[model samples]
Target: MLQQSARDFLNRQAPVKHLRSLRDAGGSKGFSREVWAEMSALGWPAMAIPEEYDGLGFGFTGMGIVLQETGRTLTPCPLLSSAMMAAAAIVHAGDDAQKSTLLPGIASGEALVTLAFDEHTHHRPGQVAATAKRTAGGFCISGHKRFVLDGAMSDQLIVSARTDDRVPDGRGISLFIVPATASGITITPCQVLDTHVLADITLDDVRLPAAALLGAENEGLAILEYALDAGRIGQSAELLGVALEAFERSIAYLKERKQFGVPIGSFQALQHRAAVLFGELELCKSLVLNALHRLDSDANEIAATASMTKAKVVETASKATAEAIQWHGGIGMTDDFDIGFFYKRARILETMLGDRYFHLDRFARQHGY
Candidate 1:
């Protein structure tokens, strides 16, 4: 009931026009400090932090609600990258001192944080090539990270780097919290299909203090996996919302659109299609909710649940958005129509954190075939 109330409230706050206005005003950057401030005032960015850290402590469930609502309207914001993924990395791995220094700023919305993990075109966290060599006083990180969400606008970045070459895959990786404006760091902005901005970052011998290490030396892979599980759940919720919105729009279009002197919804074929999409949307929601509950619980199947949820959401949302476009006819293909935006976002989210095929493979491996 609490989740429902929060979802309804956010829906009211982020209607279609508000989202469209934000998209029009904010282009490549695609974020509004003023809007973020208002959200901060509402305590959104801090929703998952523990209450002891001056946050609302609503956990992933609360974050999921906010993301779902944002996805419904395609609201231009950094809530996913800053609040969900980056905050997860900190909460999971940051030491007490590091948490004390970072969590407060993140919870209060004074600092926007994002993860810089992917070094190549792929989404494999275990394939890290960025190296961070230890120095007398600190570490010098040198390498490139691609597809860093909101990297250009984020105030702090939690970067993953290889600290030991011997352990190759993931055992050698470490995470560091570095200021986005740190010396030797350069960010180049790139645009995604939904007009969201991602960054390709270059770290040319970027130096940081010894205190910058997020977790124990060479122990970041576990933290990254933990963060990815939570991130996948949060993303699935957003995709669920996107599909829900598209399905609703398709239903309304069916009712209003006319063919053969009757509302198109009266047609048996369209009705069946809507029904099938509705079922898929509800199933997606169930998977997301179940995954969220697993993460928040003592369940040992969190990884598998998360993979299942992510895979189902990727498939369901993409199909729902495609059906929405088909049901809406030619107008859906135009930029003026809102359905196209949802479709585009679905396409992008389908790949982030691994696609349907990737998650399916992970899920299978988690279950031992």
Candidate 2:
């Protein structure tokens, strides 16, 4: 199966043990060139690209399968930002020149990129803080983008800014693929609770050529929605992997672990809890697979399925991870234990696309009353 191949590929390249090293180096904790190169060489950074572009061209399901393995190992790479999000945008809306310039760089793993969607201090993609003024050169962008994932590390940035402030919300926002090396751009690292440091970017009259504008001017929020929908599903796949891994770990512990001269797996209470976690994992798995399948066919329903998958996967991962820790006892909490790593990875993935509560509300909204 595709999942098996993906898992085998990761194991052969960077096993679960390497994940601990990455955690020590870049598993939501640090950044390392060693780990990044290893991942890039494995074709993970271009898993979703078309074969004509030198990518695997396996579609969302294949990409999702690879992401699940990445989540299971917690290997550090720009798989999500560069491959899933930025590449998706270029594939969908970039002109021929843009694709020739950016896609090949992405395919070869020579560049890193991330899209900045939210600029609001609150929760809204439409309310962007960044503004772009039309310049003789092209456009001059001025404003700050907060909480951009990998903003500091990206060689190129895909920014959302207002070209028409009077139009309001989604209508005015636009996307710019600005080189990080460009003058007048500043990135300050902001440490997050998850141990990773996201960048807060300041674009101070950052000038760009007209070619920098992706698609049409004053029409970015629509593309942002498309890009976000794609990213959310892949995130859900990773989330599902962690939940399943943790659930399976808990089950294994219950089977082998003994208490009062009997295997804990035989206990009624533990059995019930294990069954519940199994049901949760299976539910998330179904939803994620369903979402992946719809990505190539039904663009209209993608948002709802993506939200639903994210919600279900996040909840399953949280409950499963906690239960794995508890079931494994004190040893599980120790750094020497493997279950602890899985638990930590699961917790991190739960917050990838959005929080559990955020997705739950989104799922509800998308499905109507």
Best by lDDT: 1
Give the Cα lDDT of each candidate. Answer: 0.85, 0.79
Clashes of each: 0, 1
Query: What TM-score does candidate 2 get on C-alpha atoms?
Result: 0.92
Kindly report which residue pairs in candidate 2 clash with one another.
26-30
Cα lDDT tens digits for candidate 2, 1-369: 767876886777766677666556553534556667866776777777788777778777778888887777655567777888898888888998888888878877888878876665544677787888888889998888887777778899999898997886669889998999899998888755434557788889999999999988888888887788888888888777777776776788898999999999999988998988888788888888888889877866687787778877887888888888899889888988888777676666666557677777877887786
Model 2, position 66, has a per-residue lDDT of 82
| TM-score, per-candidate, Cα-based | 0.95, 0.92
lDDT string for model 1 (286-334, tens) is: 8887887777774345788889999999999999999999999999999
Model 1 spans with C-alpha error above 4 angstroms: 1-13
Candidate 1 global lDDT? 0.85
